[model samples]
Target: MTSETALPTPASPLDLGETLTFERDGAIGILTLDRAAKRNALDDATITRLGEFFAAVPEGIRAVVLTTAGEHFCAGLDLSEMTDRDAVSGLHHSRRWHATMNAIAESAIPVIAVLQGAVIGGGLELASAAHLRVAEDSAYFALPEGKRGLFVGGGASVRVPRLIGLTRVQDMMLTGRSFDAVDAETIGLVNYRVPAGAGTAKARELAAAIASNSEVTNYAITQALPRIVESGRDEGYMMESLMAAVAQSSTEAKALMRDFLDGTGPKVRK
Candidate 1:
């Protein structure tokens, strides 16, 4: 399946303005948040660039690693931009964040977020949209909007709760409490934790494994699994069966099964 929009290749990276950059490594795409001076803060331009990348992950790109340059993953939204907007404009601005975040969450390919340093407010919301999160020991999370007399305008109110639970989210927002990488893993905010500088390697390793799976199976897992989980018991089972059938019916799936039966495929890890 070809992408309608042209994507950046390893030989030629796309110029996504000043805040975002893309690089290719085999089947995995690495999208870096480049505004490190602001601790990689999310702004209007950054969100638009992110939306462009996530909205159309071209064929051959099986997975993506959403990471940042420098110490912090992200510090949250740029407050300087917020000071000029009124209530109606603020509402529209927040919805733009929701739309960009939704594009990431609903992408066809799975995204692995590499977290380090500050993952606060909108930053935490952004990471929650990814399929998997790998946090470095230096990573920390918080929602300090309440302290600033502001509320979360991103999808944090929805996605963050689904990850760590409503109670923990409330606590963070209310008290401006921060959780380290270890605590993040314990609270279900991150899937894996590694040493301070090991996050990128770990995320790449997982992305490679995911990229090796049949695209059909990966699509089913990334797309259908969430919906099924949110569905009622009987409805969930029905959706699961349908997804299973659809995944198995793919030609690639049939070939993979044939290889497995012939003892040529890799065995399950012990």
Candidate 2:
């Protein structure tokens, strides 16, 4: 996790002017990129605001819905900031981006991204960080760095490859190929694809459901499942067994299991 300065005081309700908006609805923390004029292009200010918001998520929020307030979800980083710079500066710039994105990715609560329109370049990188991604029918995914004589510096090289595989990412960058929402879902890039204009609602629904789970269970899933999957078979099984035992031993888990055994909970009927 990246280092964050301690907030001087509890943050007031964010005023959504033109850059980013943060709101709390029930137990869901809603983060909307509000810079529609530039297709919500992520500039330095936007990045800083995002880092601050996620770093100090208000008390009582259990999940996050990351969405944009325009036709496009995010066009990626604002290339307008690109400039002639030394290797050290470039490395630091990339690290700053990584820090902000990592804060969102590693949030104590899970994040769900609602994607629509051009989810390209750095935009795709941001979406890849979310725990769950819901894409509208109009959504498309691409990485156009190759044609532009540039490379992804926003953690895409590490995160995107994990979601959709390295070969596919390479093909996207090399060929400027764009995948529509259905294809993205089929290829495992997106977890859900809904009709146009439904991405946000779907994401909210999923977030709400996820927020209902025991906090410990959710935390384990978000923090441990990925690592378990990457481990060797023996290691993976051991992790699963351990997590299972730990979860089952929880008071909430025991109560839920008792309810089920007593025929008072929902059954596993298809």
Candidate 3:
């Protein structure tokens, strides 16, 4: 891990302004949504900044923890940003959101979201984009777009369904139902759940653990695993085999294996 003074410059300038705050804790990059006045509601600028941040994550950052200020992680999109538009314009707008969410979901390093309070509508969609989520006990998720006579504009229709299943997402959208953190964990919406104030700590712990992994293995787990799972069985097997071979070929992987055999590597523990 590089020291803060020695960190590489970002690929793009991270002048995301006050709505988003970016910092580094060793190898872990932390991004916090800071629009508490709007319950950290996302707007065009915020979403665009998110895309930029992920697109140009500083070199050597192995993982990210996405959290927010105030009580709520997010209450969804800023309704004030809503504008009437024709079908063509609306389609383009939605596509922009899809692109941003895709950037998060497909980032090279893992992203862990710390969820608390309301995770509604676009907020739920946003959390779904993270590779892993740690929800506070106070967290509650909902898709209220349906109640507002609108469907999800983000990648929720695809990503959320993939996490929790089509039926569950369908139910949430159709009825504007809200699920608490426990229920969310039960349905696999979140990977971890903790006390309200402990979310960030837990997420940091997870990010640290993720940062300790070999980059090649992490890449295979984050990048190849999802595609392999989505592929046809034969194709999936082939992809997995290829990824396995590639990962094992890395010098870091070989060194780690040598350490394991030499009794110098960390062992799996509960």
What are the lDDT figures for the candidates, one per model? 0.88, 0.84, 0.88
Model 1 — which ten-residue stretch has the worst lDDT? Answer: 1-10
Deviation (Å) of 13 in candidate 1: 10
Write down the RMSD of candidate 1 (Cα, Å): 4.2
Q: Which stretches of candidate 1 lie over 4 Å from their true place?
A: 1-15
TM match of model 2 to true structure = 0.90
Give lDDT tens digits, candidate 3, residues 152-176: 9988899898898999999999988
Among all candidates shown, the one with the greatest TM-score: 3
- List TM-scores for all candidates, in order: 0.93, 0.90, 0.94
- lDDT rank order: 1, 3, 2
Give the lDDT of residue 153 in candidate 1. Answer: 89
Task: Give the residue spans of candidate 3 off by over 4 A.
Answer: 1-11
**After TM-score superposition, what is the CA distance of residue 249 in candidate 2 from its true location, in Å?**
2.6
Give me candidate 1's TM-score against the actual structure. Answer: 0.93
Q: What are the per-model C-alpha RMSD values against the true structure? A: 4.2, 2.8, 5.6
Number of the candidate with higher TM-score, 1 or 3: 3
